[model samples]
Target chain A: MMQEIRQQTDANAVHRDLTRLPLDTPAQQAEFDAALQANLPREAAVRRQYGMDRRTFLKLMGASLAVAGFGASCTARPPEEKIIPYVQVPEVMVPGRPLFFASTMVLGGVATGVVIETHQGRPTRLDGNAEHPASLGGSSPYLQGAILELYNPERSTTVRRNGAPASWDDFRAELAGLSSANNANIRILTETVTSPTLAAQLVALVEMFPNARLVQYDPVGRDNVRAGGSWLLIRKSTPITVLTKPKSSFPWMRISSLVCRVACATRGTLWPATPCAKMQTRPA
Target chain B: MNQLFRPAANTIARLSLLASLLAGVVILALLLVNDQSPYTRASVGIAIEQPVRFSHKLHSDQLNIECLYCHATAEQSSYGGIPDTHTCMSCHSQIATYSTLLEPVRTSYATGERLVWEKVHDLAEHVYFNHSIHVQAGFACETCHGRVDQMVVAWQAQNMTMDWCLECHWEPEEYIRPVEEVYTFGYEAPEDQVELGMQLVAFHEIDVDRLDSCSICHR
Candidate 1:
């Protein structure tokens, strides 16, 4: 290998004219002849004196064959990748790129706006939506980890009743049967629901059954504070403490101000009696 | 008689061994050369088989549809974004409704299953490339993607190596085009290309030093 490399380097230096050399002297010619002789077929006498035995030769052949076989087997042929195009491609997607959709994920009864990065149509990543009010370009750990949950293989894929597999249709049919039966003992048990649609549905179900009752229970919930807030409204008029911090991370724009308004409406009086409250009430 | 045959057999054995060694070396060299060649890469200059035989040449070159019409997020997001099935159905539904070639497309639409497209010019996972930043920098899509509008199958024309990216990053004035012509497929250089590009670079306030930083692409 070394000799071959040296010859190749010399050949390249000589502009690839391999037919003749500029050997000017007999001594130089002799040196060239010796170098050429070194590459010629060796005599049997030299082989008998110093060459490896048949055992060594066989061992070498076995090693070389094993190495070559292993190398050949190790090289993974890249799979024949296919590009499956959309039969009816959506207006928002392109062929070779990822698309982001602005959506919301419910965490602890509050909806946090998130932007999901979809490769083809499968959600692969999640980030907070910069434009959304709940999440201003920042996501909680739960929202960030939602993509993993979306792709989790262990996630339940079917509805079940009594630990037996049942489809969504079966569940719906059961719900229909219960509603039609209209039993006087019918009761609805649920966790605190901030969603207006779900709350309305529960209210309508109770109204449908004259003797039916609806109960809200949560192990870790904010409903207690909300219930206390309602009681406070009915009882003695509590002093509205307007806590305004000058250094605010969130912008006091339409979104944050609306949040403040909801806080005031639920827990305390909306009217600002203090001077600081009046000063901080400017719509920014 | 036995001694005479033994020498002859030994000579033949030695010759065969030498021949096998030489053959192995030659085969190994050929394999190495073949592996390094562009033809073996399978990504460049070869037509990638897609589910639906979509043609960019027909849409962009013949029909004159803008690149951004389908890749709507190119200028706004990090990704250029592949169009959804509904986008193709908007046109293909009427034209190729009964064609057997569009069977996959129709099947996907009916079943609501997304077609998984194999990316032709995928970068290393560690490298982060933002298409919006490049578009905002006034670099034409063809500058990196090559003449995709002219291709029927859209094979990767360039190697897309880090070295190749660095070549333009070192001298971005030569690559920068006007923002209006960013989507142009095969833009020709004007007589004063260098001067115009330099002026545009200045006008756009593109920080050349910032572009050359490792964090710019690697992050």
Candidate 2:
């Protein structure tokens, strides 16, 4: 029955245009007749499986509905609901009104600034932050969908060590033990450090240990763009994207170059150039 | 063959038919009574218990504290907000510091746990009501709430059914008063209430035609 509906839907799509135009021609009439004829047999088979005529089915349905209605009317009262008021409400928070906070979400080294709407304390919705250079009141589908990730059930909710559940203190103690060893090769693997504070911390960590290194790795990294000689240069604290015209006439190269230019221009100081490179090459 | 029925049988049949009709009428009357009863409505003079028994009579009547002092959002937001525990402690901390009755309020303030207050005038989820709009339109708080200053415990005074809402929506001029009288507990409507209300409605630019539209409240 499901397969029959799907076939009918597919057939309907093919004849969708035919509906707008009049079936004036004999050929058009014949095509419509053919589509209808194809569906009639399956529909007849489904009706036969039910083994009840329209009148009999209606009578049965009416009788059952009357019984259900009688049963439902016996219970009149709805379940009681309670309203819990905050002990010490925040100065800014009003019970019914939603509050918005400016934040950033990063995916594949690209950061988008967003304003999150929170009810009481839980984040409910996300929109583009109007003031941020990365978004400028416009958001991509990725930024809009980032709110779902906060409540994603499959997301890792605890620290793990060697594929087993571990506490943060345990991880910290182990890290301290590892760092105490003078010749330890501590490699911190992260996905795109965009925040200035995080980059500073990474730099400080690398400086602390002579052999320590930080590697920013994304599955869909812009290695091709870097190889294509599209560099985002920071001159006088402002990012300038000098799009060096593609040496080759390849379509992908041109598209990549365009994306690089847009990413660099809109991204601005979101991904700082000096600190990012310094953190990467300092240990090396 | 003897007759299958006697004259007495015909009377019995007619009497049975009349009894069935009477039974139907009695059942319908019972249903109507149930529909209008306070037990079914679960509101209108039903004072739901709260974690802390806060008295509006003492606060708003004796002390003469404004309704907006605690329910501050009523003038601005859709909800007549239940005051935070902090709002209660602001005064209770100094005045009734060690009162046994205020133990819940103190516990909530100290432990940072919320006090679950049962709603007295709960509306259906589908109905969209904005207290700010009504208050701003010179609809007195007492008009629907009914002398809250006199009640020891807060109870819903109005049924707040769709029909009750339509009574005002159809003829708003019968109820609307001056804006200043909105928060007043026992505001008496002037003799020329309809006349003043008509002018106020025009002054507020309220479109009477749009009031009865389904989306006005349902949405």
Candidate 3:
């Protein structure tokens, strides 16, 4: 008998934190509300009456102050604001409406499809594209934070070599010189690439230089299942395993399996209510 | 005579206080009223300057080109994308390539840079407005944007406040039109507009409750 277990540890995947208080019932909500109310300032009765907390009331007050300050400044004799109209307006762009473009965000060689919201010409926000298979309308944190990265003031605007500014033409000319040297002692190192087109390009580059070599280094390493398969042959041992029956047939058994802890059930499976409490391992 | 004068003085003081209170109320009301006035609404009537002196009046009214020819994304995406430089060169390459006015366009095309057009009807950062949903819901381009077809220099027509958006969302029947008539400028509502609007709302499956939620526009 042999057993192979597949485990998913994609850090980008959504995981519910077990340490957080679970508010699954109305009782929990009422308890939380009570706790919040107990800590509220005594002077915030007026805010509470309007269904607002002290924090929200303070925020509103701050916003009012900011607005008043802004309004006072605006009333002063400032330079006249100019309105620049287009000489030839594109038919598609409305003067004031935001536009969305379908784009992809890559993290660790995996691409997640996202929709980029552009105001004027700058990308302002990123939302998961529902049409894309990888995202399914939910975005990872990387995709959500991409807009800040786009607007980051400290991001590189030009190519650099050894902390000095460089240009693409200069780099290309340098590469051409090296290629003409016929130096067979070339080594190209890259992170794990999943795209076939990129792989093909790397292969072509290696072929162009007869002695050139390409090496892929992945920080996360390869799948453990493949590693396990090879180890089983080396040891020549059989691993005993037990598979849980359908939840309808054996509900208790299904609930006890550790796999049931994280894997959502698609058919006749009940979600473990108590987190780790339901992880029951049985002898095969 | 002294006691009588004291009462008179008290009455005068009371009357003056009341008069001043009324005056303050009037002044505040005037300020509030002035906020939405056409003169106070920035860029409402003023012609905005552009890199190119493009006239909507000439292209839309004179040339008879459809609004969608340039704003192709409005029907499918949240934005009506500004046309690329090629879109300009498509016509101006042969029409007015040598004109001083077309110099910027030529330079942008030659250098592969974009002409940054000044935005006219920009909304606040908090509000989430989708152009496609309105267009798909049978709203004419002029419904919120006013008449761009006649604008020599495009200007803001609507106040574009939360109250203005809520007023329409609460009573969308007045604004709802046929999908085909959505692009039609100066579209008039039918005589039984309220009843027709009710039917259209139901047909379109527009959840009135959902539309009125804070999250609908805020996030």
Candidate 4:
């Protein structure tokens, strides 16, 4: 049996060498001949030794056939599954048909509008919402990955204090105690605020604590580019740039427009050029 | 050689050999029978009980209510959606308001809890059966369901095995009818069924060659 296996491996090596050989040149033909000569003698020697008698071979084959026959009968019937119907079906919902809802996903301070496709109340897919000013029927990998994040099992579900699980009531009581201490130093750390409701809340929180400080920080913020004099304007957290600098000789070839186009291409929030109207525009 | 076995022992050995052969044959036959039996398939004539004893015979056969009235999405959706509690109360609120038979339905509507009806005809998970495509192809409800209007307690009428589905799919021209007769129960094919089915197959634009493809049903 060992001799037969060795002979089989030798034959396989020869077959592999033959397939790998490019017979287009005389050198390759010579190499192929060398490989064949090296393996042929060992194969012949191994073949001369007998592996198993016919009777033993027949017995093993018969045993395998019986085992296979028994294995075939072992498959059980499929388990039962239930189909639970809704108590009150939504007006617009039809079973097996998907409904798309317009929503927004925020990442690193930028919000992109997306259309989420839901099947029977479970969101199954996501795409860019065309009607929204921020999306304009375009999407990014980060926007698509939001679905994975939404369904991620490792996502934080409850309040935690210093890596240990805590409750909201306990946190609220601690916060009340700290505020009532009169001279407590409170520092609020948050991402860049864009939503009007959140911005108003943060302002009210500071007003109530008098000495409390609010710090807005974004890891991927374009502060470096702004400091480097890149003509990028920030107005109410929306990145807007002057498309046509009137005083410049070449208004069309302005670097600011090019930078703005590249920066805001995925954002799809290019404001209409009205010479910086209303709100004060700052570099950072 | 030493007379260790009696003369009658030869007859016993031969009789035992024959009995063993008979037993093997009997076991094989039983296995074959069990494979095709309703106990294994769990289908055909097994009426599963539901929370409410809703009778198809009364609603469909006696009252002559159309099948589409309850399963409205059957023509447009893959699923023949089960009627919600609101659909039941649509009629029961005025008709069977005080009946004890509809107490579960009333309680479900009042509390906004779903009625846990037992599923009768459950298909294999891999088989992606669509009702709308079959309905649009002009296959009558009775073609596969087999006189559901006659069923007092709903039961699976056909085995619905892969071979049973392939029988219609293999030769769609032999089964299809006019679109108007899709919801008509107890519909009988005409004498010129093959000829009419051929026309309907073309009218419905069903690709016969693609019907038998693995992805068509499996996917």
Q: Write the per-residue lDDT of candidate 1 for residues B1-219, one digit (tens) a residue.
A: 112244577899999999999978977786766555555533677777676788999999999988887776788778776776777777787886898877866777789898787777766667898888889989998988889899899788887767788988887889889888998877897888889989988998888888789898887
* Global local distance difference test of model 1: 0.69
In model 3 chain A, the worst 10-residue window by lDDT is A265-274
Q: What DockQ, on C-alphas, does every prediction get?
A: 0.17, 0.28, 0.10, 0.23
Model 3 agreement with the true structure over B46-140: per-residue lDDT tens digits: 67778789889898888988898877668877775566677778888899779998888898888766677787776666888889899999888
* Quality class of the docking in candidate 4, CAPRI style: incorrect
- The reply for model 2, stretches above 4 Å from the true place, is A1-71, A155-170, A183-187, A206-215, A230-284, B1-36
For candidate 2, the share of real interface contacts preserved is: 0.64
lDDT tens digits, residue span A179-259, model 2: 879778989999877678889999998987889989999776655555444445322222334333332343254323333
DockQ of 3: 0.10
* Model 4 lDDT on a 0 to 1 scale: 0.75
Candidate 2 lDDT, tens digit per residue, B1-219?
Answer: 234456898899999999979977976786677677777766778787777778899999999999998998888888889888899999998997999989999999889888888878878889999998999998889888999999888888998878899999988888898899898877778899989999998988889999999999998
How much does each candidate deviate at the interface, measured as C-alpha RMSD after superposition? Answer: 11.1, 12.5, 15.3, 12.2
Give the DockQ ranking, best first: 2, 4, 1, 3
- Stretches of candidate 1 off by over 4 Å are A1-159, A164-172, A175-187, A193-215, A221-242, A245-284, B1-42, B55-65, B69-72, B83-86, B89-103, B106-117, B180-186
Chain A accuracy as TM-score for every candidate: 0.51, 0.54, 0.49, 0.56
Could you give the CAPRI-style class of model 1?
incorrect
Q: What is the TM-score of chain B in candidate 3?
A: 0.83
List pairs with backbone clashes in candidate 2. Answer: none
